[model samples]
Target: MNHQERTHAVLSASGAHRWLLCTPSARLEEQFPDTTSDAAREGTLAHELAEMKLRHYFQTKEFGKRKYNAEVKKLKTEELWQDEMDGYTEIYKDYIKTLALSFPAEPYSAIEKRVDFSQYVPDGFGTADCILLSGNTLHVIDLKYGKGVPVSAEENPQMMLYALGAYQAYSFLYDIRSIHLVIIQPRLDSISEWECPLGELLEFAEYVKDRAKLAINGEGEFCPGEKQCRFCRAKAQCRARAEENVKLAFNPDKGKLPPLISNKEMGKYLAYGEDVAKWLSDLKEHALKECLAGREVPGWKAVEGRGSRDWTDMDAAFEVLKEKGIAEEILYEKKALTLAQVEKTIGKKDFAEMVGGMVVKNPGKPTLVKESDKREAITNKITAEKAFQEEQ
Candidate 1:
């Protein structure tokens, strides 16, 4: 997709979950405009870095042209264009080459290929980070720059649509047998994969075609869910989302308690606190917009958020720390090591062999969480001692 076409009317792969569930959201979103965000700018830099690394790997670009500058024109210096991004993009390039190595000849590889999924969704198109067309399989790799949310490969409509687009574009030349959808989240240090046979993928395409028809026409229902509303532009003012959150809170005017909850009831609404948190955040943002427009709400007024004092130059302040005879270690907090980063650095087998023994388990702090959380509950010391005595 070119610069102009990038913002056209299309059921974007990224927003597939939103339109598929809350079909009217696509139309409603047209009223709102896009805003440039820090996260979005960071993502742009990451994608540019990825493109440069991939292009240089294939020997298409000149040596000096491949270098990346953190400071873009009229943009603040990016802190993300360091060893982390470089290392991850190397891993991405290696993954593509490793898959292509198995082929008899040098397999065809494309970076940032503009894929058209219009066969399934109307005017649907997005750039695939990398596509490796090897023997009997098509590998579609997507590089996600965000670290806040971990994306999965299982039943991901966005990646699935990309697969359809890639298959349609290359099927004429290659006898493709399967489509491999992969999501490489570098910041999370995760590589998730999903494979679908040609037949099964086509079935999903048909489902998408029907959904796209309804979504484009605004004829579908406004069924709200966590997945659908997470990235919706109109989420702050969505009627359906508000209604869903209201259902969780009971009638306050009625008598105090609603009696005890059963096992089934507790399991269902255990994780709903996050939804309430989202509602509060969205409501405040909505009210702030009205306040800024000279339409103040009843009880709330616009107020500046808290800010911290900062040195004119942080490096100069750090130099002052050296003059005071403060140890560098005392001045700087060492970044903690994550399990994912460790495992990624060394292969799983070597990690288990070399450094796994040094690992230690610490008791996590007591937390009130949803029953759906995978972590097993850790009982309090009193309860544990009582149960042990009873058993004796």
Candidate 2:
């Protein structure tokens, strides 16, 4: 497919999680121009590299070795190319191969396939990185290059939507009874999968349909929350979000400050903390941008912040420092390579075989989390002892 010709739908699959919650956000974001950062560019480059590797492996007839080598060389010439990306993309390709082996026969695999689900969602479409079909099961695989947050496939709206689209497109040709969604984040060493019956997927599709209809028309109340507002373009200026955060500071029941917060209430308050902090940061940035653009922002003006000095020539400065009897070891603090870096240098398989037995993971510090969290709760010894003493 000509990706350049493809236009993003108002109710796009990727933004389903956000738009489904805050239905108005999809339309509201249209006013803001889409901006790309270095991180986004790096992700795009990684995806391209991954796709190339998969094509070479799966469709060697179409993508010849010579062509693959030349394409990879061209990709390496790009500024964002990193040596680590090569290893990570290989990991993705290997995982896809393993998925293929799980099938009884050679599964029909497609790379960078475009699937359409416009029936449920108006003009809804997205590209699945890799998809495999065998017997009664269809696997929709996605590669998440970012390591900022580990993504899970369990009831994940984005993965579910991709599966829905792929199923819709290929159901006629295959008896697809089960749909499997997979999210692979090689950088984080995360591979999560969620499998469901066709009936359950269709139920999810109905849910998407209802939300997409509301989102397309900018209907439903603005429900501002942390995850939904994180990437919303209107997050900085949205009155609903501002109001929600403001309401978090006060208790509607008591119209006044409480002497102390109970432990039970603290969890609820802490949940709002991250959202409030992010909202304030985004608001400040927006105000600074407006001021920089010659617009008036009440009680705020753009000014040069404190700047740090840097050596004009680092190598020359370092040499002069060495000549002045400053010890090289003192000037440059040496540190051991991280586990991940060492693993990468030695090759993952070899590193694991050699030092995997030596590696030990200690218990992490106890952290407060919601009851619905998947992690098993760790008992705090002090709290347990205190409770036992009180009972005695």
Candidate 3:
């Protein structure tokens, strides 16, 4: 009925596969706020791009189009879906070229193998990104494009889950001696890789399964911190998080204080348990606005009023020059002086002091400045000059 609700519905319907692939639970929507914001749109776009690149790679291979067409037929028949697929393919192609140049034969972009993690499923289901085969070694690369910090490839729950899924799905086809989890965050200047024995990965998978079970069963504790709460969409609804925000907003003694000898000493000494930072910030903003409006503060003096400057009266200067027997053309021409030239004429120290705190003001109300004003001023001056010439 409302904008947010409608947005959530559209996102949910369109991003069901993405949600399932990444978080695999309704609770993920509660946990990660960044995952729900406009930033999530970028992630969706990245995923679509990655998929398109993969499809294009397949198309280039023999019978790739037939295989892709068959898969598309199996998936859905929506025009919107097809358009998205095409868009993703183009994005992926560009992304892959960049990756290739950067990594150089490091097998950038998509890995087209599926993984099963049925044994590691603690509560709900989970899936891996894709499994990579490099010579005899097996590597798993996960792409994380969101602003959220990339999950460390080493000892990461998400990476471990993906490893489990990969091993489950692909072990039958390969010798599968070892598993390496690599997290690539192109947005961040980071690439982390971790290796584990086949046995170790399986053990970690089991550990993750236990954790997932606890989380699903409502036994998991909230990890409350600034970093965790930054993009959490469910923050307003979360009791623990709401309390944290209230404490942060109201806690006077919590933040860093300046040296106690100044006004800061009074602030710390009178540490009312409530946060006064917001009030102080608001007061400063209001004070600034009043000062700009030329309103006088009780204890503050108007040290200087602002005004504008203009060129000297050119006609008066020209008349003085003419009386001094100088040519009108030589005297009335425009000229610009450098700082050094000005300093020679007026001593540097005096000039510096004179100009140090100069404040320029608007000439007048902007509305008074019109084309007609200039014309009228010039016309009146011309009329007076003609009458004076007649008298002469």
Candidates 2 and 3 compared by TM-score, better number: 2
Q: In candidate 3, which residue pairs get closer than 3 Å at backbone N, Cα or C atoms, i.e. clash?
A: 33-231, 33-232, 33-233, 52-89, 116-169, 250-275, 307-361
CA RMSD, predictions in order: 6.5, 4.1, 23.3
Error of 2 at 48 (Å): 1.3
Poorest 10 consecutive residues by lDDT, candidate 3: 1-10
Best by TM-score: 2
- Tens digits of per-residue lDDT, candidate 3, 1-392, equal 01122233211312323222233233645454433445654454555455544555634574376765665464345332333334334433445455445543554223533344546554233333445554434667666665555546776655666666666666676677787777666556356788888888777666655655544444556654433433335433455544654565565455675645575555443442222343344345545656778887676543455989875896887788799998877765688996646644665446668873553444543342223232233222457668899999
Model 1 lDDT per residue over 160-264, tens place: 888888998999999999888899887777788988888988999998899999999877889877778777778888888888788766533355655886776
Q: Give model 1's TM-score versus the native structure.
A: 0.75
Q: lDDT for every model?
A: 0.76, 0.87, 0.51
Off by over 4 Å in 3: 1-38, 62-114, 123-127, 134-136, 147-151, 245-392
lDDT by residue (1-392, candidate 2, tens digit) is 33324467778888888998999999999999877688878888888889988888888999989999998898889898887888888899999998788778999988888889988899899889999999999999999999886777999988888888899889999999998899999998888899999999999889889988989998988999988998888999999999988887564437576888888777777887768889999999999999999999988899998999998999999999999999898888779999878987887777789999988888888887667656787764568778899999
Candidate 1, superposed: residue stretches over 4 Å from native:
1-8, 59-80, 251-258, 304-392
Please give the range of 10 consecutive residues that has the lowest summed lDDT in model 1: 66-75
TM-scores, all candidates, are 0.75, 0.86, 0.44
